[model samples]
Target: MLGRVLEEIEVNVLASQAWELYRTLQLAKFIGEELPNVIEKIDVIQGDGGVGTILNIIFPPGTPGFSSYKEKFTKVDDKKRVKETEVVEGGYLDFGFSLFRVRLEIIEKGEESCITGSTIEYEVKEDAAAATNANASSMVSIQPLVMIMEAASNYLMNLKNNKNKM
Candidate 1:
């Protein structure tokens, strides 16, 4: 059986009195389609709830995972955008070498969104080893999404601020 460990982090950002920008920008399509600096396109969206969306990506210097390729979103759902999005994601990485299961919850707080997120990552082994070691699958997971989240947050607030000023 595979074992699991947990990690969670919450980030709160204050924009110009509107949290929609922050919440909406977190969506997968908006970043790859609307944002100017997106690395690639969003091809597959997994999971029934808003918690999962996958983007076909190119290798960048800071991309996460055991390989240069990565899945753009591991999990995303902010209540500020749609009022409430609750879901959990569980999957394995390339083989028994790595695995992950994450849960993300977003709460709106008057111009700010309280994002409470948790994830469990561990080494996968046994029968799953060979299957995961193959070429990148159509379904992928983006690991270490901290930087993307930060950029999206900045873009959200700044874009709104610019629009309002004009």
Candidate 2:
């Protein structure tokens, strides 16, 4: 059976800012720089941070049930603040999934807040559906990403606040 999952998190940040961060690869760069404990590094394997861009994400040591993975951008819409990426190598490919794709969208709630929505779609190999389903279920829990986004939002807001104070 094909497995599909979708999740979303609301953030106290602007949609334009979130879209810029996703489209320009600044989000990955920021996480790699500020949250080494969560993500060790992010390397661009190809493309220019747009559709068809390939990225290698390395998880920090001791990160449970995860390591490095390669993902290719399938779609990126700046106007809509949406991005779709597929795990072409590593990650769940080792878990019997024949296909794995993730879509992220940032929807504006107001001038200062937005929603980060993520959709996960995958297909499991025959005879391995059960195990793959279990694994995919765990992967669908995107708490790490939410945490990273929250940290980044707070950092940027604080920076802006400090500048205003100055």
Instruction: Residues 77-102, candidate 1: write the lDDT tens digits.
Output: 34333222212222234343444443
Worst 10 residues of 2 by lDDT: 131-140
> Which ten contiguous residues of candidate 1 have the minimum total lDDT?
82-91
On the 0 to 100 scale, the lDDT of residue 161 in model 2 is 74
Give the runs in model 1 whose Cα sits over 4 Å from its true position.
1-26, 30-41, 45-58, 61-92, 110-113, 116-123, 126-143
User: Candidate 2 — which pairs collide?
Assistant: none
Error at 92, model 2, angstroms: 0.6
Model 2 misplaced stretches (Cα beyond 4 Å): 130-136
lDDT of 2 at 132: 45
Which of the numbered candidates is closest to the native, going by highest TM-score?
2
Taking all chains together, the TM-score of candidate 1 against the true structure is 0.44
